[model samples]
Target: MLRLRLVTWDVKDTLLRLREPVGLSYAAEARSHGVQLQPEALSRAFRAAYAAQSRRFPNYGRAEGLSSRQWWLEVAMETFRLSGVREDAVLALMAENLYRDYCNAHSWELLPGASETLSCCRRRGLRMGVVSNFDNRLESILLRCGLRHHFHFVLTSEAAGVAKPDPEIFRTALRLGGALPEQAAHVGDDYSRDYRAAREAGMHSFLLHGHGRSAGPEVPPGHVLPTLSHLLALIEKG
Candidate 1:
């Protein structure tokens, strides 16, 4: 069996995900503020805005000393501006509300089998923790989702000062767990960010490809899994 002392997880799209399309959420919130926005346009604008913000101020601008709130507000303003809404006051208020709204269970849902898998791991006496490329609000989000108690710690990109695809974040997690690289494994949905990067950090890695999700041919079959439930089986068999 693979000797696993700790199992670290990526948060979004792995353990949990947004309840609805982000654009739909944004549109509904905007409507509440008396601004009409097409969900589709808002979606596209959001994607573009998010990408631009990430490139300009990666890891929520930790290196530049920008708080997560400040960075997200910038993204929200840019998204609204791109969607043809230019009122600064309206954008500010909507962004604030949107940011607050997202830091709770209402905006997110746990993936199928997530809770059961975590519970199983806990019963097996495995140390569990979160290693996510998320903001500092991750703890709050997990708490509201009733998942906080399952983890020994939650390390976010904002807190770590590094993002996935960079091995340092994984190293930070290993340090937190007080385990060697080979004694830990990481699970996440992204091929590059979760699998390859974690392996490069000298840890075991599993790329989660749930039902109907694709694990590109480039991925080795041994490292690809269908869900968190499969992960426990694989760990046992390893």
Candidate 2:
């Protein structure tokens, strides 16, 4: 039987998701500053800007001396610039609003079964922590979402100096949990970052299937969970 003691979770898209589309949020911010941007266009531009920023400043630029807020401001600026908003003043205003707006719980919603999963883990005497490629604001967001108390610790990429799929973050989680890799399990929606990375780290991993979405045939049957509720059975069986 698997001796599961620690369960580390990936936050974004795993435990919680944005309440609205990124583009809608960004466009709202733009509108506040007298700019009208198509939400779809802004969303696409944001994705591009975020990817470029990640390549340039991985882990929120922790090693490069950029604070989380500063790094995000850079991403926002790049996002606006890519979407054809060149005015520095306007870019700053929009980005600043976005940064502030996203920090609150209103910006995010707990995923289905998230609370029940955590409560079940707690009932099973499991220790839980968060392992995510997020910035310092993660704790605050969790707190506002009323999920902060469920975790023993919250580890972010900015705090760890590395992101998921690097393995170092998983190692850090092991140290925090005081468990061997085999004594822990990880669950997340992303295959490479969460499932594969955790498996490579010697822990059991599960890829969460989207609601009303089917798992691809390529995924191992046992490793893809239909919902967080399925996780309870895994723990019980183990």
Candidate 3:
């Protein structure tokens, strides 16, 4: 039997989802600064920019040595090129809106059975933690959602100084959780960053689907499950 030591989870798009459309809050806040933006249009632009930035990080890390936050800010700034918004102003708006949304308990909704699956892992005596490619505010988000108590450790890319698809972030999580790479597992929705990187780091990895409408690569995950609750059966079988 495989010795299960730690169970690491991803944050955004995995455990919790945004309660409202992206930039709805931002647009509201931006209106105060004399910037006119419709919620839906701003939301679409922000999401497109976010996804594009995420895709560029691995490449930028491999080449220009850019940090995740830096990458994101660049993308965010570029997204406002047509709006005639100043760089400093755009960044301030983003920071304010992101923190406001994350810290607001009503702005985040937990995934179906996320709490139950985590409780099952705890009951099984498996050390549980979170490893996510996110900014510093992830801790506040977890606390706001009452999930801070569930994880033994929380490693954000900003804290780790590296992002996913890079081995250092996963290695740091293993060290923090006191688990050998082989004894740990990572579960997330992104196939390339979460599953592929965890597998490359010698951890068992599972891919979660059905959260959003994004079309992912055709490659299969080591274990495929539609919801977090299904992970319990996979661990039991193993």
Candidate 4:
């Protein structure tokens, strides 16, 4: 039997997703302030700018690093510029509003069945925590979504000073969970960061699939689940 003592999770796309497309949120907010933008265009531009930021400051809220607010302010401004809202003052107002919107829990929704699966894990007496590349706002998000109480701890890239695939975060999570790597399992949607990286860190890993998109730089998964409920089955059967 595959016995384990701890199980950690990834936040975005694993436990929760944005209530609306990030670009759409920016576009709508900007529209309310008299700045017109195409949501699709804003989304594309946001993705590009955010991707650049991710590459540049993957863990921006950590020590001596730019805050998440700063990083997203840059992304929001880039998104505004790309979507034809180039006025400096309007861009600043939109960026500030967008950043504030994301900080609140209202911006996210729980993934289908996430709560049930987590209840099952807790019922089985597993120590759980969150291992995510998200900024510190993750705590508020999880708390507002009613998922925080189920975890023993929550760790984010902001606090860890590194994102997934950098074994340090996983190691730190393991320490917090009081489990050794071999006795832990990680669940996430990203194939590289959640599955392969966890496996590489010497922990078992599960990939949340069937969400209509797959993360890149493929790798062999320890397990693939179409829904969160499937995870409880796999663990119990093991």
Model 4: per-residue Cα lDDT over 101-173, one tens digit each? 8867889888989999999889889999999988777888788888999999999888888888888889999
Best by TM-score: 1
lDDT of 2 by residue, 24-137 (tens): 999888888888989999889989988988889888889899998999998988888988999998888888888999999999999899999899899889999999999999
Clashing pairs in 3: none
TM-score of candidate 3 versus the correct structure, residues matched by position: 0.80
Q: What is the lDDT of residue 17 in candidate 4?
A: 88
Off by over 4 Å in 4: 61-64, 214-222
Identify the runs in model 3 with alpha carbons over 4 angstroms from their true place.
31-35, 47-81, 84-98, 212-222
Local distance difference test values of all predictions, in order: 0.92, 0.89, 0.77, 0.84
| TM-score, model 4 to reference | 0.93
Q: How well does candidate 2 match the true structure, expressed as C-alpha RMSD?
A: 1.5
Question: TM-score of each candidate?
Answer: 0.97, 0.95, 0.80, 0.93
Q: Write the per-residue lDDT of candidate 1 for residues 46-90, one digit (tens) a residue.
A: 999999999999899999989999999999889999998878899
Candidate 4 deviation (Cα RMSD): 2.1
Instruction: Give the clashing pairs for model 1.
Output: none
Cα misplacement distance, residue 83 of candidate 1 (Å): 0.9
Clashes of each: 0, 0, 0, 0
The Cα RMSD of model 1 versus the native structure comes to 1.1
